[model samples]
Target: MHSVDHRFVELLPTPLERGVLYISGAHDIVAHLCLCGCGNEVVTPLGPAGWVLRYDGRVSLSPSIGNGALPCKSHYVIQGSRVHWLSKMTEDQHHRAQARDRDAVRGLNPTRLGRAKRLFTSLLRRGRV
Candidate 1:
């Protein structure tokens, strides 16, 4: 893994110019928290993915932070993010992630599904794709 200088996220690249982005990952990944930042805490927008040793930035959806860039705590796609959804993905990994998240959500919180649903819906309420 590329050793990144932990700091506030800026437009930069990592030493290896690669990282992971997960919807609900077990490893540290990048995410754009669907909800805009609030002084209190950051909600899930960033997700996790299997670590990759390459960088590819997709502005509309995912933004790859180069090693030089510092990411906010909110941007770290670790746990506590409702990363059950994602933009692009590897076919095999996608299937596995979906199942894992699905199982993890089961009996987690009777209202968890509702909360996650709202989070996604709020992000999509723009009325335009």
Candidate 2:
């Protein structure tokens, strides 16, 4: 229910400042993360509700299969991936799910915003003031 109406999803995301998301102690892999530590910064309270929030979706769940991904909705880390893909999740059952995950993430991440963050990181890495 990550994309549920904001009014209903509002309080659920705030109180849990700390949590642990096991990548499917069940059958599916789960993407997870902690609170952003800035509640006011979180648009979750006023984030798009209903179909409107289709872009900044709070989680990654393929509507078709019903596998609710954890809270890490940002860009995925391309761990051990090839130039063509980010990871080895090209399995048939996981195909749509991964696409949904990446799509939801891309929507959340606008090019401008990502470039800004990347610039900040690059500066930080260079120890530039």
Candidate 3:
């Protein structure tokens, strides 16, 4: 069980600090270090097909983050700045989750879909997608 600190910024700083969630509303993105203590950076874009953030003093992100591509494979939810760990997913579960994510992106309107694709490509270029 760990709690995170939230900071709103226009741009994400390099070498993100652990236990701090940096949110850049201007960029519609959130970035943080992996809570698994694996020292990996996690980036979540904010949009219809991405994670939704809520802040009222404390910060919360809807839908748990599952880093299936990361070696650590961390999965958890952030609520009120606290980390809620979830059981590790089986391989089948991981594939299903990925499918769901693809479906979500496909469900977006054409304009948003293009945006999502571009955003995903940007992340991929950064080796974070």
The candidate that achieves the highest TM-score relative to the unseen native structure: 3
Query: How well does candidate 1 match the true structure, expressed as C-alpha RMSD?
Result: 13.9
The digit string of per-residue lDDT tens for model 3 on 1-129 reads 489998999877877888999998886889999899899998988988789999989999988988887888888999999999997656776798789888888899999888777877877887764
Tens digits of lDDT, candidate 2, 50-87:
01112232332222222123233222221211111122
Show model 3 residue runs off by greater than 4 Å. Answer: none
Q: Which 10 successive residues of model 3 have the least lDDT summed?
A: 120-129
lDDT of each: 0.31, 0.29, 0.86
**Worst 10-residue lDDT window, candidate 1:** 65-74
The alpha-carbon deviation from the true structure for residue 19 of candidate 3, after best TM-score superposition, in angstroms, is 0.9
User: Per-candidate TM vs. native?
Assistant: 0.33, 0.21, 0.89
Candidate 2 lDDT (Cα, whole model)?
Answer: 0.29
In model 3, state the lDDT of residue 55. 95
Regions of candidate 2 where Cα sits further than 4 Å from its true position: 1-90, 111-129
Error of 1 at 60 (Å): 23
* Model 3: how far residue 117 lies from native, Å: 2.3
